[model samples]
Target: MFSTREQKLLRYLMQTEKEMTGLELAGHLHITSRTIRSMIKNLTAILEEHGAEIIARHRKGYQLHIHDHSAFRSFLKIVAFERVNEQWIPSDPSDRIAFLIKRLLLSEDYIKLEMLADELYVSSSTVKNSLKEVRELLTKYELVVDSRPNYGLKVVGNELKMRFCIAEYVFNSAQKTTELVADPEMAAIRSIILKQTKRAGIQLSDIGLSNLVIHIAIACKRVLLHNYVSMLDEEIKNFEEQAEYLVSRQIVTDIEKSFNVTFPNSEVAYVTLHLLGTKMVSYRKASDALSPVNLVSEEILTLTANLIDQVENELQLGIHDDQELINGLGMHLKPAINRHYYGMNIRNPLLAEIKQKYPLAFDAGVVMSNALHDSLGVHINEDEIGYLALHIEAAMERKRLKPKTKRCVIVCATGVASSQLLYYKLKSAFESHLDIAGTMNLYELRNYPLESLDFIISTIPIYDDLSIPVVEVNTLLGNQDILHIEAYMVDHITLVLDYTDPELMYFQKDLQTREEVFDFFEAELTKLGRIPAGFKEAVIEREKVSPTCYGNLVAIPHPMRPLTKETFWSVLTLKKPIAWGDEMVQYICLLSVQKEYEDEMQKIYQFLVKVIETKALVDQLIKIERYADFEQVIKRMEEYGSR
Candidate 1:
């Protein structure tokens, strides 16, 4: 695995398609030429293993070349595809405006546009103004539209880009967002602190305190994941444990499940217990070699020292561990003082996975790491450290659910207007709990049709011979029409997610391979009822904003809304390969959030990152066919989780 710095350099060379000198690469990656050479040598080995090689042209930097694009493209699927559409594809000032009025263009052909006008009750002309550059955009992609006196306008080519444009154009209303979205986490932390205060019989708000905790947590993850480039025996381990320890004490739960990992496997038990009992530094040496000394984030360590000092003076909360904090940041930040460009090398595997999963985050991490070094006297590899925090946070939100349905299809209007609204409505109705495949519109529902859909509901009535349950609504979205349908789905998904997969939650004693893992998770979801808003269709649409895949043979497919569960959950592992965008992912840990556990959602979120880290464990779980054995594994994990 290449370090983030190496990966960034590799991406730049691939994108630039030109020779970059060592000086330029060092400048871009923000590392010394000597470090650049080490990174290049390592990268060459990784690429060579995959039947590709990096060419070093004298003083010039290096270039990765492969004879085939397919493998490279496949690799891209695991990393590059995560940040595919974070940027807004814009218009050129010189381009011509071309508008197509849906009213004029089609009477029988349906392309719904109500969401765009939803807030404004948009008219055809208003849409035209917004789409002034539509024609120019289509032309740039080498598509042509033949226009005449009789036939006003028509799209003549480039089907993919046009369809993509149309799909994304109306998708803005779906409220799709990049997750670990900060807003919710902040709120959750605040609520927890308030509860803690209430328990302690104190009246303090601790408003900024939650942020401080989160920042410290992020910093600790960063140090463990990002090499400080200083001393060999790093002190980051203690910092990370401190962060987790603080969270555990304040929140009354492990960071992975947030609710407390009750039956943690041996490894989890060890880690959690170590954090509670010992300094994070010692835990690092004992748990994983790279883990210790890596926990100290330069900024967080320094800021933590300062904050503790202030708190000690004002609140009289006695904190004399200032030396530890100083030691943590003092060394980590100094070596990071001179970043060449993209920042230091990508030495951390977790950070590499994160960067591979989210390009924008990787880029932003680079910029932020360098800026923080310059401005705050804090130095660290931003992607490594920054995203390590992301992983920890994500792991906390993880929810392990079982296949709740036999099969089901969520019908919205061609994924627009009523369909779009109805989709999220049903998911919400189910409390965001359901084992769903993909959602579809009433029109092309059969085009990407599944052999089995246990149920279907829509505004329009349709009859089919397939024994598939159908609930017809008057319109796709709103009051009685949509609510009744959603209420039913909630029940179905609840049942499937809880009962069906419960048998498979145990850990298997045997090892799993790539193939056996494939057969599981290709099942269904029926309805239970009263789920959180925005569950299935809404979740699928959220995915439209960005592919849900987090790269590295894993993707956590979920809706934006939270769901309600019945306390117990069933985990369904796929036994067959399912295409997760550009790559194939063997596992997807579905979650069903039971209503009472809202405060502890962070635990499940954090567990997901752990799953990503331990791919081998996931592979082992996927290979088990017997639901009974799966239960054993879950039992093992649950037993060990409490530590």
Candidate 2:
């Protein structure tokens, strides 16, 4: 049987078509290059008989080649079956940290470091290092690892925080909740939650329902262990007055009868807090009597309006007038404030995807987060920011549905008949794609409304520079002229390559940390007089709002707001991957956009999103050392995007 690392290595190789160097594979697996070499040699021997071979290329790296598809499929099936039955062991530092946390949380008594190391099949020192990360993670939940000499270590925190931490670390696993708790018990808890919420007319999202079930199941487990959440007399009194408290009591009573266990009044209040925190409000038009915004308080409405205005000011996305966004965000904020009041951390499973796919909207979410923090004094986590981004992204999508066509005015030096002929030809060629506002002479273009136009399609060469792009075409309007006009139409996505400065590109740099990368950018850009001294400071502030690390070994860092006179990218690729926020990153693209081009920044963000999402593209780009080769990759990306 293949070892866990070998299986992971093979899985990674199989997922991608591109070659992966030993260093790259090692970086991903969190192991030494020497270990990767040894593993590949052994894995090669095993895979050969299974109709697969590991191809080692000269300087390129290794790739997986399957000679017999049927045999490889059979082998994968066997591996899948084995994985289902096999006991999982912690293979990486992240895995070990999670394992240690789960073990410590579940255990009532102190657990020895040596016992943990033995269970994880790792050295005591490894467990100790992992515990440091575990301790850091626990601090977020106000929990700590109480280390007692000779006794070992135990998790120490408030019962409420302990359950929250448990819900996050233990129950929030790749494996289903039923895998951790008994399936029957989880099913019963879920059934009770669904029935009670439905009966109370309390609409809950699928995630909210699952969270309630997990928390109640955890409460049951802890209560059986003689651990109960503590609450002040005043707090319980206030909770009892809420409608959620009555619903919670009914749910808890039914659970008690089914499980043959009793819950204290404080436990019912605990359930009520979750109900209030995770409650969903259906959005409706403000004109409707049943609108959620009608139920929302003035404070929340004002806050939501301010957030929308702030995002619109920063992004110029024109979403401030979106009624659906206004209503949805107002409704989301009501529960969000309650969650903050109760110290609850609602999980957003789509946070990573949201960051990658809807990056512009996510940045808008960041702007909203900063506004909320300033107004409400609540620091919204990435998960909550992701939820906010969803609303903004929906608004963005709605805006996209009625996309603004490329508007152009024809400039003709000839007579009206020739101009009309040219306009008719252009319209016949690109009727759906372009909107010809009107035709005018070059002299009349001086007085025309240039602000409303995307570009000017001129028959004759215009000598003067203008605010909008001017595409000079033949009076006859040939196929090549049509293609040139088309290029201008799609320039936002295709012109991304132009933003990458060859002088700004740094490849295979020996940077050790995020600070080192920042310092390098500061020094280089400063020497070139490309940025102000405050540029790095602004970027750091942006990172503080939310780390720009979008996984896939890529990070696109930028100032919180536009600080440059022109938009451009300063690219940096490290010799080795460095810790970037919660992920590892080697490709850092320092994006600087001009203040006036904030509207066009969305296109740039979309381009960066494509780079972040395409693992193969990032891997290929990071490996490149030459500017010419980098240009080729970017050109390919542009071509692929155009398709």
Best by lDDT: 2
TM-scores for the candidates: 0.26, 0.85
Tens digit per residue, CA lDDT, model 1, 200-274:
333221322433333323322323333122211233343334434333354434233442323212222222222
Q: After superposition on all CA atoms, how large is the RMSD of candidate 1?
A: 29.0
lDDT of each candidate versus the true structure: 0.43, 0.85
Displacement of residue 445 (Cα, Å) in model 1 is 58
After superposition on all CA atoms, what RMSD does each candidate show versus the true structure? 29.0, 4.4
Off by over 4 Å in 2: 1-6, 13-20, 23-86, 112-114, 121-129, 147-152, 175-180, 282-289, 417-438, 446-452, 458-488, 497-500, 623-636
- In the range 496-522, model 2's lDDT, one tens digit per residue, is 776767899999999889999999999
Top candidate when judged by TM-score against the true structure: 2
